[model samples]
Target: MSSPLSVILTQNKLTGENFNDWKRNLLIVLNFEKHSFVLAQPRPPTPAIDAPDRDFVALERWDNSNLSAMCYIRASMSNVLQKQHEEHQT
Candidate 1:
């Protein structure tokens, strides 16, 4: 079973509405925890005509040196995603 903190850490979706706050908070939390991570917002291949209509893709990358930490984080994220999928299906 994964811990609640791990699930909360990985479950946030970075959207334009809260981009600045999300980035700041994520950096602070990950840094304080000594977890190396990269938060990137990639641009779509085809740009949207309207600025607000543009889709932003957020990618998170982290080091896998610590096996336990890696597994814990991955499992937590997987569990949350699975729950989200099931919820959408119902």
Candidate 2:
């Protein structure tokens, strides 16, 4: 269920002792995927029906980035960690 690009990011999965390296690698991959923005920004609130177009667009972008980051994070974790974090978004 993971993307092929996960291979590039998960060369060394997030073992407990490797937080620094794992985070660095994950950020590099996330940046390459153009999803690093989600790390710096909080999730935007959902737009109202009559909200400006830009609001919808921002929410869409946030969703894409959040999903991508979540998948990558899961793909790079040990099975135990992944299960514990199944529903985490940030």
Candidate 3:
């Protein structure tokens, strides 16, 4: 049997001070053949933030061969982050 491969898709956001400005960036990190790679998604670049830094991020891993793996991985990561944020609010 072959070992499973994994990939991570994440979105990182930087928000300005006074919560007045925001920008979101997407990244993908893959793990294959015992090596890792980081790629920036082909999307619009984040605009400059006007205030102090805040971060929002997510990460997900999945078996590379499965159909719809990318979608599941992304959703899992987002759900995890959402739960974390909700916990912090309490």
Top lDDT prediction, candidate number:
2
Residue by residue across 19-89, what tens digits does model 3's lDDT show?
Answer: 22211121222234321222232222343455323311111111222213233334334454545544331
Candidate with the larger TM-score of 1 and 3: 1
Q: How many residue pairs clash in each candidate?
A: 0, 0, 1
lDDT of 1 by residue, 1-90 (tens): 244444345565444465565456455445555543332322234535553432322211232213333343344343545455444311
Q: Could you give me the TM-score of model 3 versus the true structure?
A: 0.18
- For residues 1-90, write the lDDT of model 2, one tens digit per residue: 255556766687987788898998888788878898998999899989999999999999999888888888888888888888888767
Query: How does model 2 score by TM-score?
Result: 0.85
Candidate 2: stretches off by over 4 Å: 1-5
Least well predicted 10-residue stretch by lDDT in candidate 3: 55-64
**TM per prediction:** 0.31, 0.85, 0.18
lDDT, residue 30, candidate 1: 50
Comparison by lDDT, 1 against 3, better one: 1
lDDT of each: 0.41, 0.84, 0.28
Badly placed stretches (over 4 Å) of model 3 are: 1-3, 7-38, 41-72, 75-90
Model 1: residues with Cα > 4 Å off, grouped in runs: 1-12, 37-62, 65-90
